[model samples]
Target: MGERYEYVPHRLLRRRVRDIASGVEGELMAVISENVSGVGAEHWVELAYVRGPSGREFTTSVGNIESAPGGEAG
Candidate 1:
């Protein structure tokens, strides 16, 4: 497959950014740059689905990362 997705959120770990999504959690292989904003902010992102429960198939999204945007999401 020639298609590739970027890990805007995960890559920002340098900015002290760590995100967790539903049905998925923990470290991922690597985060790449899908789209970078002129404002130095990430609009869209793709995660490698580092950790997940056994027998569970789920995809990661920026929405999940935005929900908390850091941690302790209500």
Candidate 2:
């Protein structure tokens, strides 16, 4: 069997993120890094580090990320 990959939406990457502590919204600069794994049958988790325009970074985890429409997984 071959390893399966997931696709992240480019739009989502560009969306602004709000800081929970101060309620400030910052622009998402880039997806700095990502880690993905299958936890069980039909279940997966992805952890991604996103950089802000101000050079701040934050970690976010998402589950069951699907491939983008008309796009290939990476």
Please give each candidate's TM-score: 0.28, 0.35
Candidate 1 structure quality by residue, lDDT tens digits, 1-74? 22344444453232222245353444343445455344654554554433333533334554454222443322
Per-residue CA lDDT of model 2 for 1-74, tens digit only, reads 23454455544455555434444444443443233335645534454444545677665543212223332321
- After aligning candidate 1 to the native by TM-score, how far in Å is the CA of 1 from where it should be? 14
TM-score result, candidate 1: 0.28
lDDT of 2 at 37: 39
Task: Tell me the spans in candidate 1 whose CA falls farther than 4 Å from its real position.
Answer: 1-24, 32-45, 55-58, 66-74
Q: Pick the candidate with the highest TM-score.
A: 2
Provide the RMSD of all predictions against the true structure, rounded to 1 decimal: 9.3, 9.2
The residue ranges of model 2 lying beyond 4 angstroms of the native Cα positions read: 19-24, 29-42, 53-56, 62-74
User: What lDDT score goes with residue 37 in model 1?
Assistant: 42
Clashing pairs in 1: none
Candidate 1, residue 47: the lDDT equals: 43
